[model samples]
Target: MAETILALEGATKRFGGVPAVRAMDLTVERGTITGFLGPNGAGKTTSLRMSLGIILPDEGRARLFGKAPNARTLDRVGFLPEERGIYKKMVAEDAVTFFGRLKGMPAGKARQRAGEMLERVGLGDARKKKIKEMSKGMAQKVQIAAALVHDPEFIILDEPFSGLDPVNQKVLESMIRAENQAGKTILFSTHVMEHAERLCDRIVLIAKGRKVFDGTVNEALGTVPRRVLIETGEGPDAAPVLAAHGAVTDDGMTGEGTHRYTLDLAPGSDAQDALKALVDAGVRLARFEPVRAHLHEAFVHLVESAEREPA
Candidate 1:
């Protein structure tokens, strides 16, 4: 059984009489990576902040480890807020140590951890340099290291990949994966579907401040119809056989002597039947493959469907 760590009960928040988040409820189990996904102005960040207790919600409640979001719970959790802010005048290493101590870490231990982190991020030589001297990527690594200094069991990272280069992005990816492997429950939010798809064990998709989809990537992908690309040595007439099995999207473009078409299956479609029909139609098959759809397609489908509905 999964150990429950973070949860929200009727979590709601507003700004100046405008409802930002509406009774949001979610559970992030311990020792798993949870991805928070949504488009811009979708209240992903606002909901996260309310959950972090950095901003009190106008309504609802957020609990960390069966307790309210308070200093005690805060100490046991690592957070990299969406809004990044740090002291520019302090040396890179010292700044890390200061933040670490604030989270109840011993000064000497925090300093040692800071040194190790700086080294891991390839900034060991720049430890004495002020934050202003470090590049944006280096500063970002500092932010990440600060979050891990106290070895919190739960991590909440909001757009932790923003402004990072591909190399730094990979570095953070490995770190997140490692943390999860070490039994740290993490809830990471990002607009980049590729990272969320590959990194998260399960996804909590949000739209307009409400949960749109909550499940594994496979579950969400299953909600959409599969598009199968079929290439045959026969011809366009094969469409008749393909459609006899399922609806197709081919436009009679079977050549310049080429036989290629597409089939779109309805929900709960049995793709094998369609393949069998094509084979039985005497169309010598050259290539037949299911078009792999990821989180992006499923997300777009849900968001567009929602928009098409009445406001």
Candidate 2:
């Protein structure tokens, strides 16, 4: 069995009589990229802080590497907080090396590692430039390199892709993949569904300070109903036939000559059954394809379902 790298059992935190996170149970196994997903103010940062022992949890427990997080265990962890900061006067390479040294690397080795990391992150040319002279994306990449310079076994990144353009986001995604491929246990927090969808082997979703879902991408997708797009010939409308097989419209049908309709399948309802119904009814089908459920849809469904649960 794979070793559990991190575990939080009933971890809870509160501020001023209000809960920030409540009874959260999460476990990250070794060598897996786990995406901690939630919107802003959803307690992602707080939970991470607690896991790192930066703040004491109001209740329950958080363990890193099967023991309480502290200086010893933390040396094996690399963390990039949501807030980014670096010494304005410090050279990029120097800043990265400084952090590596703090993580217990020898000064000479830290400097060597920092140079290699900066080059790998596409900042080789800017290694001698002061951090204040770099662009926002460039500075962010420097911080990321600094976090990894010590070669920690585990990595935690909070909103690492935030404030990055699409191109830079893709760059960060590639970096994350490289780290995972290097056998590092990575846990990254993000509100963006696309990042988690494309990169994570598992995802844990929190909403309103409560854990709403936890599983693989496929399992998370299974939480929401599937959708199928159907386009029928003008001769016969397929909407009515589909509606009988679990098709629902948020708004009542309004458009005339509408040959295209999207059907949401309820639990246990299969797209094949809908197609068979359409064929048996002699509906002229122009197109039939199952629309795969996206991570965004699954996330929304989970949040909405949690919201609807009784207090």
Q: Which candidate is the best by TM-score?
A: 2
Q: What are the Cα lDDT values of the candidates?
A: 0.84, 0.90
Model 2 spans with C-alpha error above 4 angstroms: 250-258
Q: Tell me the TM-score of each prediction against the true structure.
A: 0.92, 0.94
lDDT of 1 by residue, 8-115 (tens): 888888798888777888899988999999888888899888787888878788888888889999899988887767688989899889888999888899999889
TM-score of 1: 0.92
Clashing pairs in 2: none
Per-residue lDDT tens digits for candidate 2, residues 248-296, read 5533333553367788987788899999999998998767889888999
* Colliding pairs, model 1: none
Cα shift from native, residue 109, model 1 (Å): 1.4
What does the lDDT read for residue 77 in candidate 1?
91
